[model samples]
Target: MAVVNKNQLLDFLENRVEGHLQEAIRVFQNERAEILLQPAPDGGWSIAQCLEHLNGYGKFYLPQINKGLNQANRSSNSEIFKGSWLGTYFTRMMEPTTGTKKYKAFKNHIPAPDLDAPAVVAEFIHQQEELIVYLKQARQENVDAIKIPLSISKWVKLKLGDVFQFLIAHNERHLLQAKRNLKNLEVADKS
Candidate 1:
């Protein structure tokens, strides 16, 4: 098990989690439904779709995380968090890197093109807030020992720490995609 500074990890996750929250709010304030629903010039997912997809993931993971946190054995806070090798590997795989490979969403996670833009955005914002709560709860739990089953396959499980890392990275990846989609829409409008 690889050890990490628990305080540092918490701070990192908190900063990124709040960033997503603020980003979602900014998107809600600045973009209208038409702009959010506009598809990429090349027929990729629209900004609304990107967020809806994330919401789908959140719908599955958030509850499981909450349940895990609730059931986790009460223990004194550790100064360091020990990460499982498999979980760490999965998190690293999902994280965004320069020239990262694109992954297709599983069928159930795909959002319909006609999804309500405002609702999708609002759901994402709500989910991020819920995730922030879990991050705080995690400070008191043995995150490395609590296992969360994967939504994609029930048999596959990951440590809570890895789950947080993976989900946050995944959200950031799509948020960046949504921003790019909006930028492309702007360029098209000006053309």
Candidate 2:
């Protein structure tokens, strides 16, 4: 993927975060957990599980974004610097010097079979709200300056701003999975 432009990212969020926030809330307002958790035919995650799994990164990104904002500036090449685990993995796999490589994908589900859908949706909403607050509070200068490890996995380091970008992209990727899960739910209903 192309390196995200700092000013462009700031501008993009400034213009779009509110919309994304609202859109997310609207979609989530009516989720049914049982329907969501049912497995898909391709053996992928249920909607409930995917949402929970996607938020897994907030444990790392939320704190890292704060650190990037508080730390000193290293604006030059911040985005380009090798990422911790996720970033490094992405960089090496998607190297400009190398031919295209498949984007590796994975998923997990926290055990909570009894948890209701709204509760899980509530947690996701909480995460999105936290992200909105963080992104809104961040400065363009900080966006260009800070780089944090993408994971303890040392996949790679990422620009603090890119943290949000990855978050949005990652969420959408799973949301698509959830939508697919819905289709599977439909197919099962027919069967």
Candidate 3:
């Protein structure tokens, strides 16, 4: 992982979360339930399912992040953030870009076919709001010193900064997937 200014990293993440929140409010929230529920042309998850899968991750991560933040006592004068190799690898894999390989969602994280679209969207918005607040709080502590446990294993942990990076990247990946699903549905409707 590359070394970066801690504040700069947090600021960048905060902006991303803000963008996601705005998109949810401006776009996803206004989408009809049927449209949101409509599955992708490839038979993948629907838009609502994508959001719900993200929500499942948020439920696991947000509380863990809060706990880590509260327990952290180390304060660093230097703003530099050095992510662990593992952290970097995880964040990079989760980032959504053209040609990123698809991965199956964990069985626990997979969302049900039947979901209340409005409520799912609302929950996602709320989680993003909470994430923004956590990012702000992280500035007061040494991100490298605080370790948050992974959802998959309690024994394995990542630095606070890495957790933020990974979680945000995961969110971005799923949000893009949801938008793609919506676009495919629209195209299908026209056809």
What would the TM-score be for candidate 1 when compared with the true structure? 0.94
Least well predicted 10-residue stretch by lDDT in candidate 2 = 74-83
**Which regions of candidate 1 fall more than 4 Å away from where they truly are?**
none
lDDT of 1 by residue, 102-129 (tens): 7778899988999889888988999999
In the predicted model 1, the residue pairs found to clash are none
RMSD over all Cα atoms, model 3: 1.3
Q: Which regions of candidate 2 are displaced past 4 Å?
A: 1-5, 13-20, 72-116, 154-156
Best by lDDT: 3
lDDT winner between 2 and 3, please give it. 3
Q: What Cα-based lDDT does every candidate model obtain?
A: 0.87, 0.60, 0.92
Instruction: Tell me each candidate's TM-score.
Output: 0.94, 0.69, 0.96
Ranking by TM-score: 3, 1, 2
Better of 1 and 2 by TM-score: 1
Q: Compared with the true structure, what per-residue lDDT tens digits does model 2 show for residues 94-185?
A: 33234144344543334344446676767777777777777666643555456767664455667565566556666656666677778777
Choose 1 or 3, whichever is better by lDDT: 3
C-alpha lDDT of residue 152 in model 3: 90
Expressed as tens digits, the lDDT of each residue in 107-128 for candidate 3 is: 8999999999999999999999
